[model samples]
Target: MLFYTVMKPLVQVALRVFFRQLEVRNPKRLQVPGPLLIVGNHPNTLMDPLVVAVNRRDPIAFLAKSTFFQNPILKAIMESGNSIPIYRRQDVETGAEKLTPEQLAAQNEAIFGRCYDYFDRRGTIMIFPEGTSVQERRLRPLKTGAARIALGAEARRNFQMGLQILPLGINYFDPQRFRSDAFLNPGPTIRVADYADLYRQDPEAAADALTEEIRQRLEVRLVITRDAAEDELSQQVERTFGSHLNPDDDPTTLYDNFQLSRTVQQGILYFEQHAPARLAEVREQLSAYLSELRQLGLTDEALESGRQRPGTRLSRAAKATLRLVLGFPVYLYGAINNYLPYKLPSMVARRATKDAEFVAPIMLVTGMLTFSLAYVLQTMLVHHFTQDWRWTTLYALSLAPTGFYALSYWNNLETRVHRLRALRLFRREPARTAGLLRQRGHILQLLGEARAAYLAARTAQRA
Candidate 1:
């Protein structure tokens, strides 16, 4: 408890610094006081728990796979983070295959006993019902451990122990990328008391029912697709339409994109059921537009406003040029000062791991360590050369803000470059640019028409 108390603030700070935008929706849903079980999808391995843990006001104990505790260092870290390990049959490696069924039962029984005790004390526990992490839009089949644990604990206390199971949907916008966004959407709480009578009669049936309910609730909160292909198309459509809808690139744009994807999926399903041919035509148009965008090296934003008037184009170009000219000196200084610390994590992660899901956490932890060490070393060098503690302190303090400025400057520079390329294409190849613009306009028109038709069909069905 003491260890968790000490580390919570630091962990929260680290998470805030790691992700560019972390939004928690419906946080009030978690405010109910009682024995709580946080169940969520596992998309990123270690990072998933941390994201949830840091967001909540109360500390949450997590059930982690026992395999992670095999390493002494990891075991210590997990223990410090208030994690309980559960042995899984799939996690047994090599020699562990020889373990008898009795032994496995004994281990899990002990874990469950501990869980019941924790719940009795009105403590909060987090479990990934899916049991494993995978980067996918759809939720995998959830295991019954979470439900069983909650029900078991409540049963032990004659259903007097108020246990609430909160379903959360963790949505990552490019999970593996640095400075990506993550949204935590909390669903309504499932009260264990509501199912106490059923559990008393048949425990297994009650567990299954609760598990299915959790899955259904999570599915609603998540941006789940039918399959991988649909997921891919949804992402592409999101990127294109998002640029159109969210021109300023607000932080909430990611969540907005998620909602947009859900609507698109429904529209596609509507077409699949009633108008397959129309759906195919719409898909082809979308694919062709995306292909043309790729070929021209242009983002959807480039086509927004559809071949902007010459005056507007010139005005935007002038502003971008002015920003570049004015910000260059500060950007240069920041780049030079922060370059090594910034680049090392990405360089190392690219070489070290093949799994894309692991990359962001690796980069975040690695960057935290490397940047801190580098800053200290730079401070020491500055002190050594100038022989003034005050100058060294000033230099050390400037590292963070300047580094932040460099990151902002880099993003702005990239935007400017993209706009410049679009402007140049507009000037050099007017006919081709105009053709692409017309194609984009046609695709948007088709999508809008299809959406209207789908909505009309739904209205007619209801009528």
Candidate 2:
């Protein structure tokens, strides 16, 4: 509890910096008082809980897997953060104690009893019902433990606990990346007492029914993909022409992007079943176009820019170049001051694990340490030379803002370089440049036709 109290503000800051846009759709739903069982799909390990926790002011007790408690240091941290361990069969079988199935059941039963006691006091509990974390856009078959616990807790209180289960659907636009986006969609609360009649008749069937309802609620709010192929195609389309297609996209939130992803995925699935030939044709053409763009060290942005009038293009280029040159000194100072702190996290994270889901959290933890240490050391060095507290404080404050500015500057510089390369290509090889632009135009044309047809089909289906 002491640890949680101290870390809450830090976690909020970390999450705010880590994600570019993280919008919770139902802000009021999170305000509902306990006893609440907050359930979510786990796409990123460790970070998912932190993401959910920062959204609410109240403390959320998390249910962690038994393996996380094996380490003595981690065990203490987990306990202090209001976490309770739930043993899984696999962990028990391979654990040092090697407990029997009977022992495992007894342990879980005790945990449920503890949860019931917590609910008696109206404590909030967070659980990932999907049981395990995997970095993908699909939900796994959820375990029945969450449902059983809710039902058991409610039944223990004679269906008068006033407990509710909140289902949060977390959509990570790019989880592993540093400045990615995420959208959180909260589902309506499910009162455990609503299923009291069914539970009395058959507890197991009641749990299944409740779990299925939870699944449906989560799935509808999530951007679910059938497989890798469709997900890849949709992502490619998004990166290339998403802005062009979604002209009215709101930058403040990623809900529109989430819907766009879901719609693109649905369109892909529709074509797969209804017109395999058209799907295959577009997929091949898209792959070839992207491959060529990569070979030329260009993006779809360059091809589209080629279509713009020369004066308009060069005028924009001139302004960007002047800014790039003027910002060089500040960018260098920031790069020098913040390079180690920015780079060390990713370097350490790669050596730590190969799992995609674990990368972001480890990077985040490592980054917090590196940057804190770097700032402290840099501040002390500045003070040692100047012996001025105010000067040192100002220097320390400038470190982070300048670091962010450096990042933005570098991004702009890269975009400028790409544009320069594109301009050179267009000048030296006019025919080749025109061919690429024409090919891109044709690709969009095909996409437009398919998009219209698929949208019409969707509308007709709904009608």
Candidate 3:
């Protein structure tokens, strides 16, 4: 609560000074006068909760991973923010064989019970269905935890409690960067009646229904700048499900557990009919939507595409010259803009994909410059005030970028690498050279194939 007292004002002051404008929506709706369960899509690390806190005065509690609670300082900060701890019982790597059906059911019931109690008491709880942050464009397949909470709460109270679950979409222009653009968009609240009975009979399905509804709402509100084409959709599906496929083993049956239905197929077809005029916008919207779904942990197969071979020496020379001519400025601006946070007003920073690993060299360079400037200032202060250079030299050297790099080497490096890998998928330009028309045609073909596959699988599964 104290952190909120100091943090909100500081955030406002900082956002005002750094950004051209700060926009917020649904601030009033956040103060729903009941036991509120604020559910959201996770996008940024550490920043998601802050955005929600900045919008309200209430002492909201959030469920954070148990690992963060291990650190005394971090635990204090989280506790101060009124965050609850969620402990995962099973070791993720032990695989399904390690758990019996009975054990899994017991664990689910225990978690459900805890969340239900919290919601019943009118305690505000924040949960990220995706469980982890991806690039905010699409949501991953959500864990059933949120659904369990909502359903369990409904069941325990016989769907009569004044409990409301608010669907929040956290949209970040550039996550993992300071002073970036973000919007805390809220959707209509879900009532107990929406899924109480369904949950009582089949909690898993009820949760999926709730998540799908949230996904639909999120697709409309969270504005993603780039759009995906038909081909890009294939690529997205590939990226999502690529790891699931095994080169050594081919399965006889294809599953349709996570797929769009025939009605959605018709809707997508209708949208594509006007794709020429609205393709860019629609593609972006769909891409953003699918990206969110991906974050929710759904696995889709990767799209298959062929790589074009380089031409003769003359053609190669021409290509090299073209790349050199165009790539230099983009690269130069990207390198220089590394000094600024990706969230800054500078177009250069904004254009660069938010890859934390790529930002390291930039941070290191900027840190060196900052340290040098500080050292010079401190040296002058010491010479004028005390005639002693020892303290100045010690402080300056200790705070240098090299020292900071050494300190952050083991941990920050891994985090940067992980983020870089995640962002790498976004950097690819699947439609860059195929010519817009050709790419669109390819995408349409792929979309048809995906739909056929999904329908066939669904029909077979039902049989």
Best by lDDT: 2
Candidate 1 TM-score versus the reference: 0.94
lDDT of 2 by residue, 1-463 (tens): 8546787888778778778887899788886799999989999988888888888878889999998898999898788878899999988898875788999999999999999988888989999999999999999999999999999999988899999999999999988888888888998999999999999999999999999989998998898887888789999988887886677898877888988888888888889999989888889888989998899998788667766899999799889889988999999999999999999999998999999999999988888889989999999999999999999999998998899889999988878777888888999999998888878878888888888999888899899
- The 10-residue segment of model 3 with minimum total lDDT is 253-262
Native RMSD of candidate 2 (Å): 1.1
The Cα RMSD in angstroms, rounded to one decimal, for candidate 3 relative to the true structure is: 15.3
lDDT per residue (tens digit) for residues 85-165 in model 3: 665544322433344666656755775576677667777778887777655356677776776677668777788877887
Query: Best candidate, TM-score-wise?
Result: 2
At residue 321, candidate 2 shows an lDDT of 84
For candidate 3, what is the TM-score?
A: 0.49
Predictions in order: lDDT: 0.82, 0.89, 0.54
Point out the higher-scoring one by lDDT: 1 or 2.
Answer: 2
- lDDT (tens digit, per residue) of candidate 1 on 304-368: 63367889877877887898889888888888899999999999988989887778778877887
**Local error of candidate 2 at residue 191 (angstroms):** 1.4
Off by over 4 Å in 3: 5-8, 11-20, 88-114, 176-179, 224-463
Candidate 2: where are CA atoms >4 Å away?
none
